[model samples]
Target: MMARPPLPLWLQDNLTLRLQDGLLSLPTSSNNSDDKNSSLTTTYNLISKRHVISSLVIPLLRHMRLKKEMSMRSKQNA
Candidate 1:
């Protein structure tokens, strides 16, 4: 059995950030309910700190994670 190589510092940091983003994204419901009242309530809910952080952080984290994975894989292959 072999241990995997450590990720480069930047990649390690990125993965950490992505993990944090995943944690921050748990408060929102993405379901498309036909109930107008629920929809309106959700819109208001987006004003909360959790919702704001999740919206701003998740996509950027996902993109960064993908980029880091690509680089990490390339390094491994080389």
Candidate 2:
């Protein structure tokens, strides 16, 4: 497989901003039972680094990989 290209500066900046926003938006823990449940879910969604990585970054990497593979195949066929 060809070496993967580096992510564009703009994309890196966007992802950084998203991660920072997610971190900042993390819900604080609460004592009330109902609030606890909601906060747990919110924390899982907002604070888990894996959420952003899996949801946004992985798909982008997959798309980039597929594009590179297609280009390599085209070059080989030429």
Candidate 3:
């Protein structure tokens, strides 16, 4: 099969960078009235993401520590 010419490395990297940088950024309000609602939504979404990542990490760390302690105790008994 004939292969097509590859795009330049710089073009590929720029596309990926643009996608990564362009995510659900909080909306900005020029007036005071709309600011309250927009800000609350932004805060809620940010806090939820933080909570989710923390919940997953904490249990994994606890399990790892417990396993390490058990192995150490077993070695001492042997």
**Clash count in backbone of candidate 1:** 0
Cα TM-score per model: 0.35, 0.45, 0.45
Candidate 1: C-alpha lDDT: 0.64
TM-score top scorer: 3
TM-score of 2: 0.45
Strongest candidate by lDDT: 2
Q: lDDT tens digits, residues 6-53, model 3?
A: 744654564455446542244454566645577776676677556544
- Candidate 1 Cα misplacement greater than 4 A, ranges: 1-46
Between prediction 2 and prediction 3, which has the larger lDDT? 2
Work out candidate 1's RMSD over C-alphas. Answer: 9.0
lDDT of 2: 0.72
lDDT of each: 0.64, 0.72, 0.61
lDDT of 3: 0.61
Error of 3 at 74 (Å): 1.2
Task: For model 3, give the 10-residue run with minimal summed lDDT.
Answer: 21-30
Window of ten residues with lowest summed lDDT in model 2: 22-31
Q: Over the stretch 36-70, how does candidate 1's per-residue lDDT look in tens digits?
A: 67775665555554554665457668878999999
For model 2 the local lDDT of residue 28 reads: 62
Off by over 4 Å in 2: 1-6, 24-47
